[model samples]
Target: MRIAYLTIDNINDNVILAQTFPLLGRLATLPEVDGIDLFALRKHGGDRYRAYLPPTRIRVRVGNNHGIWHPLTWLHLVRFALQAWARTRAGAVLIGRNPISLLCLSLAASRRGTRLVLDYRGLLSEEYVLQGKIARRGRMHRLLRRLERWAIRRADAILCVSERLRERTVRWQPVAAGKIVVIPCCYDPRVAGRDEATIERLRGELALDPARDFVLAYAGSLSVWNRPEAIREVFHAFRQIHARTRLLLLTGDLEAAQASFGDEAAIIIRSIPHEEIQHHLALADLGLLLRDRSSVNRVASPVKFAEYLACGVPVLVTPGVGDCPDIVRREGVGYLLDADLPLSRIVSEIRANRSDFRARCREVATRYFDGDAYRALYGELVGGKAFRRLPESPSVGKACA
Candidate 1:
């Protein structure tokens, strides 16, 4: 049997590291996975994450540069169909994401003995609408919903990024309840475990006076949905309590983000490699994740949430941030942001339970968002529990040979 992962995301995209790459790696780790192929409509050639991969197969369609409006977009779909049709055979499972990929891949995966598995990584239409990219009931909006319904009906198994997302998906397609599984934005435990020396060096490089200041870190896209003004508000709140508070902004477009907070004692970092995120995160006393409580947010799972925890840094997030709210309160590893006064409570509590929260946050990361969880979930998807607890091990799950 062969398993294929199809996506429209560029192969080198930072998100692909945490999403597509880790998934394919987990499947490749499985002994039962005979052949694993990753099919991406890539931005460029060669895989940047090849070193991190667990020897998975790769097949990509390059030169895709446009969105739905472009004529080349449809051509990309036609090319994918031809390529997928050529490789069509018995006992194949195509795990797909993105509306274009899932909609088009479903057509080719219709061949006998091929399975279609939809991984709804995000609530696409809802998100786009919230971002003001589409009208509430526009032509594009309806088309996206139609595609989502089409995939839900055809998917043999469905993977959701969060439990709330899975529930919402079930609400839309009631009959899909049985086939759904929640697979969150996962983190590699290894990335968060930097030695003391590495952390110290990173601190020096960033000129972080961690001994005095409370370093707060926020990485990834600085999207409008993040409520950029609220992020500034949180920082000012922290600065009020702690005089030496500094915010670390790690994003691809640091210039735009830095302009929002001019001349503050902030370190604006752009294009930092995915692996190096841990080093910067290590210097922080707390991680910050605050987004609008839009309907699209209810099903959202932010990779930063898991990565922060894995690095043993507590997160300060607003309520309704996917599973973080539940985990933060339940585990006492983080706090919920109060818009009226965002950082006061977390800052005070953090002073007393700094050591305790560190351990608990890492624990939560392993229990919930660890990459190992996905390994088991994928294992279960393929057959009888491909991921299992080893008799001799204390960890939650281990890859089966």
Candidate 2:
């Protein structure tokens, strides 16, 4: 069946959506499927706008972006939705993080008898609340939450990035249980394969002492909620334990993080292209996933975790947030430290079992987080009979929560 994937964000620029786009590319390879169309919104010169398909045969459309701050952006988005409805004979429309797109697509799908699939990346309203950008009980927060609930209720299928998020969505809107599906953000090993020379070049350029220093790496947005403070604490602990240890932070906000960390024992590199991530991961000895146990962080499925695993790197994670720790512990891929654990104890664990941890990292990715399994899962969600039935309780929510 023909499917149209819609998102407000530029698909090429969005990290998560870009990773998912390849998965859709794979789905289009299936025998029963006709083709997949990707419609992304792009900003135009001044207020003028237009729509055009991507050069790739995947049938991509770049709809006019009414500058994010423009008062008429929503109206323009509605117009784009109507145009998409008129142009494609899609059986379903998969809507991404854009709520305005969700509302418009839902309406269009209803009119065309096309199914609407809502891919909820995160609880955007809750994220604002945790960031202190919006108060929980504020009128704007309430209004946004109402709209989120409406989208959840209207969706023919709801895909969440993590099980915790699926559970939370249902708790917030009970009717969501009937439609919600958890398709955790994952790593594909194909994405992990990098040229050996490129990998070596990056390691040499970074002056990474792979044989001597134990590289402790963290890659992603160096934002406030990620608890850069805790990461600094871990680096401090790493310094005390091993003289040959160094912390590497790969982020888009390297300049800001360098200012934030001051003279900390960490090397901060500004963001690298997605194609080069495997090389950076290959040069690293260990991975770090540290986030504060805030409401916004609790249900996150940070894409970095999968990237780390794909590179066969061991991870050290903070407990009680995301499924990373559970995946680490259950798969024996890495260590999970309690938030309240003594820094000395954390350091000791890392020093004591470093070898086994690295081996486990490779094993876990092959055995549990296999890319083939992920592909099969996506295929089932899109084509199998189970798509209509509610997923089993254990399969649809957080393991710990």
Candidate 3:
């Protein structure tokens, strides 16, 4: 079976390298897949990330000239859809990585008896309101919802990043629920190898003592929903009890992170190359994933959750981030902060129970966020066969196979 996957993202965004490429690489390995055509409708104008594309088994066509608000953006979408539709063979699968992409291809999907798959990552409309891009339930929000609904209704299969997201989508479009499958944002634990020299060097640069200082790390962007202020609050609270505690902010927005935590000498912020993130995360004992409780976050799956666990760094995440809180609680991999748990106590518990955390967190990563299972699911989705869910995961289980 052949496949076409489309997404609208800035070429420079890390998701293209970390998320998209990895996913396509896995799908290309499936025996049932003949080849894949990736359509990247970049929202900006650059080819800085083009060099990172995977091997030729997955052909990439990047459309990198139109901004989201540009008058020609819709026309560009139509033209791109036509190009994708023309390239597809009969019975080929067309997968949209977002709502707008699928909405554009809905008509084309029905033409050649091809399967349409919606890769639902999050609630885009609610996210726009959270980011102040559009008002809640306003004109633009309603329009986006209609488009999403249209796409979801027409999809032959739907892939959700979290169970909560699947549930919410079911409530929104009850008839489409049966086609949706939950597949969280996953990672290959092999990417997070221990490098003692790199860890020591990062410690030296950050002025953190290997024996005395405990590092709390927050990786990824400082998006509005991520609540950088909440991270700062947690860091300060930890420092109040343990003065040697240090905060490391590894983000792409270096200037914004510096502006937020510049006055604190105990805090270190830097924008480093993506390849070096594993070593930097290795330096930390705990990972911070704080986000405000909103509809946007309620059904979201942040890849950092899996990244932290894969690195053997237990998370200190807030409640209501997809299925993360439940996973954290059930798996004993991290602490979920609330009005009940004191900051000092949680830190003390973490420091005392540092041993064996690496093993346990790695186990959780394999059980819940393993990439192999997702690859199996994607294989089945694109293979034009009846969907058969795999058994729940055990140790290296085939939950989606």
Per lDDT, the best of the predicted structures is 3
Q: What is the C-alpha local distance difference test score of each model?
A: 0.73, 0.66, 0.79
lDDT by residue (tens digit), candidate 3, 1-401: 77888887665687667777777778888887788888776765377666666665887777754666576776777777998878877878888888988976676686676889988888878878887878987999999889888878988888888877877888888987567667788864445667888788877877787578888999899988888889988898888888999998899988888788886788888787676788888888899989878888989888889889988889988998888888888888988989898777767777787767877897788778877756667776776566566567422222221
Q: Write the per-residue lDDT of candidate 2 for residues 1-401, one digit (tens) a residue.
A: 66667777654443534355655656676666677766666663321211112223477666565665466766667776776677555455455454556876664575564667777777777877876767898996897788888888887667777777877888888887766656666665454576889878877877776556777888877666787788878777777777767777777676777776776545545577555677788777778988777777778877778778878787788775666777776676777876575655645665577667656676666554444554544554455335433333233332221
Candidate 3 at residue 322, lDDT?
82
Angstrom error of the Cα, residue 99, model 1: value is 3.6
Candidate numbers, best TM-score first, in rank order: 3, 1, 2
Question: After superposition on all CA atoms, what RMSD does each candidate show versus the true structure?
Answer: 4.0, 4.5, 2.4
lDDT of 1 by residue, 1-401 (tens): 67777777676777787666777777777776677666665565455656656556554455474765568866876777777777777777777886667776776687898878887777778877887778989998998889888788877777777767777778888988777667677886456668889888878877777457787888887776677688788787778888878888878766777677676646445558778878778777888889878777878888888899998899888888776787777787777776465466667677677778788888888777777656656766655332333442222222222
Clashing pairs in 2: none
List the candidates' TM-scores in order: 0.90, 0.83, 0.94
* Superposed Cα deviation of residue 216, candidate 2 (Å): 1.1
Model 1 residue pairs with clashes: none
